[model samples]
Target chain A: MNKRKSKNVFINGAISSEFIGQSIAKHQSKTTIGAHNIFLGQVRADEIDGKKVSAIEYTAHEDMASIKFHEIREETFSKFDLTCMHIYHSLGSVKAGEICLFVFVSSPRRKEVFSALEYVVEEIKAKIPVFGKEIFEDESHQWKVNS
Target chain B: MILHIKYFGLLAEVTGCNEETLEFSKNSVSDVLSILFEKYPDLKEKDFQVAQNNEIVSKEMVISEGEIALLPPFSGG
Candidate 1:
């Protein structure tokens, strides 16, 4: 429909289970949507050099990251038969095992969402200029790199 | 020309400032980078990308109008 305007996609901290539940509840009114696919990215407790990761502090070049997010949304909409889509990423510190990224896509059928969801998530991981500092349990930190 | 330069992630950690306006008499992005490397030798050992006017740019790109940013590898989910 092309009516999806650029929206703020960042939250100050982790995305709570309550928020996810409410989002699903809000979509109950959209009877036209038959299937919804969701992807939740959890921070891993990665260990490096005898240190365990405790949390991740996220930062972004906000203006550019927002613009990139909008482009990814537009591209996904054009490529898939999605009724609606939403993406949210965490800013600030998110503890390990907490949700940092959430992508929800709805369609009339199940198959469209299956592929569209992955596409959007992959594009974001590759393109967005968001950075993370992995804080170790001992208070030391290292930069995270996507590979 | 005076350019607004931004640093993010590891680049900011190395540069010690999030952003600053610098006077550079360079013709290309690489030329400006050389000056930065001279000022902060630690930066040369790390990997990063350059963005001009919010677009990722190569070192050969000409230095032109707009803000410049030095971005480290992205780790966003």
Candidate 2:
């Protein structure tokens, strides 16, 4: 609603759908954009070797995670020209096949929307401080962090 | 001085806790690792990267008060 508060990022324990919806509505957007692209990253149960990944226990050094997210948010905004953007990522434990990160990008034009959305998602994946622990179906586990 | 360190990933399992306060002088990240590896001999090989207050730091990075010393491996996607 305020000029200075349209773009924001929520890096938290677990992102709720309501929070995602609210972040979008903050723009009070009336552009009537021809396209709006959204990407939701959900955890999927998979088998590694003979081990099945039943769930992911997500954790982060909270202070650092928040700082990282904030920096990424500011960078994405400066790089992309869009009507609005919002990013939310899960912290603590997120089960297998559950949503862990949600990114939404909207613009008046479809072409810019696609490119901006992709860039934001990629940057978040590459730079954010989130960590994952893959829980095997048999209850064994291992941590999953990006290289 | 006592340094309260936090462990993530394989390091946490090896240490048996997410955090521990240890005795050490005011030193760089490398110094902390030298002490920790001596205490938990098994941790030397896993090869953790050090972070002070969430940013990627080098071995010579100095740590001060109220900072979370992290031993995390690269695990981002």
Candidate 3:
């Protein structure tokens, strides 16, 4: 296993945007890639039938989440011909409108990069065991677990 | 047998503790859940996912003399 792949797995309450960008740059160096695409997921503050969501507190069953993430990483590599990929998610609290996730993928061409990015996002949403606590501006909250 | 069950997220709110040990007959995950529901009737309506020893486990997983069980809702990506 390469250092790039093994170290891409992270579980933290917060991550630096520059670090993510650097990681992508590092991965892109080896590939004589024509294109790179990145997706950044930000939390949105919205009204839920009258209650306004102000922030989100993300949590996870860490033990299970780590294992699930490792599995997804392997599956993504098999599904895409991408040079490399990196996935990072925020744990603990993230305010509304703050970026919560960053998915970066690079391939030899643009077409594969787009597809791989989408696949990684979808797989993370469907399979990862991270939960979100939608905090209303008024301080009320609700738990959101991806189905 | 007495088994320690840990609670996370909303389950922690309902149980008011991170973990507790309850005595039960040698039973499966489902059986232990039923026992929990009987004691805390409020949890009957809440959806729960069980894990045994830090791994996501099915209801069919058997409980022996000493094991850790967790009742947490699906909170993933």
lDDT of 3 by residue, A1-147 (tens): 533344445446555677776876686457577778888888777678799888778876666667767777777788878877777888888877767888888778888888888888888786666668888888888887555
In model 1, the Cα lDDT at residue B32 comes to: 92
Question: Which portions of model 2 show Cα errors greater than 4 Å?
Answer: A1-28, A32-34, A145-147, B74-77
lDDT tens digits by residue: candidate 1, A87-126: 9999999999999999999999999999999999999999
Q: What fraction of the correct interface contacts does each predicted structure contain? A: 0.88, 0.43, 0.55
TM-score of 3: 0.84
Model 1 CA deviation exceeding 4 Å by range: none
Give candidate 3 regions above 4 Å deviation. A1-16, A145-147, B64-77
TM-score of chain A of 1: 0.98
TM-scores of the first chain across all predictions?
A: 0.98, 0.78, 0.85
Model 2: per-residue lDDT, tens digit, A9-115? 43544566787778667656655655677888777777788998877777666676667767766666677667666676676666676677888777778888788
Screening candidate 2 with a backbone cut-off below 3 angstroms (N, C-alpha, C), the clashing residue pairs are A43-A97, A145-B75, A145-B76, A146-B75, A146-B76
Candidates' RMSD to native: 1.1, 3.6, 2.8
DockQ scores for all predicted structures = 0.91, 0.47, 0.53
- lDDT (C-alpha) at residue A25 in model 3: 64
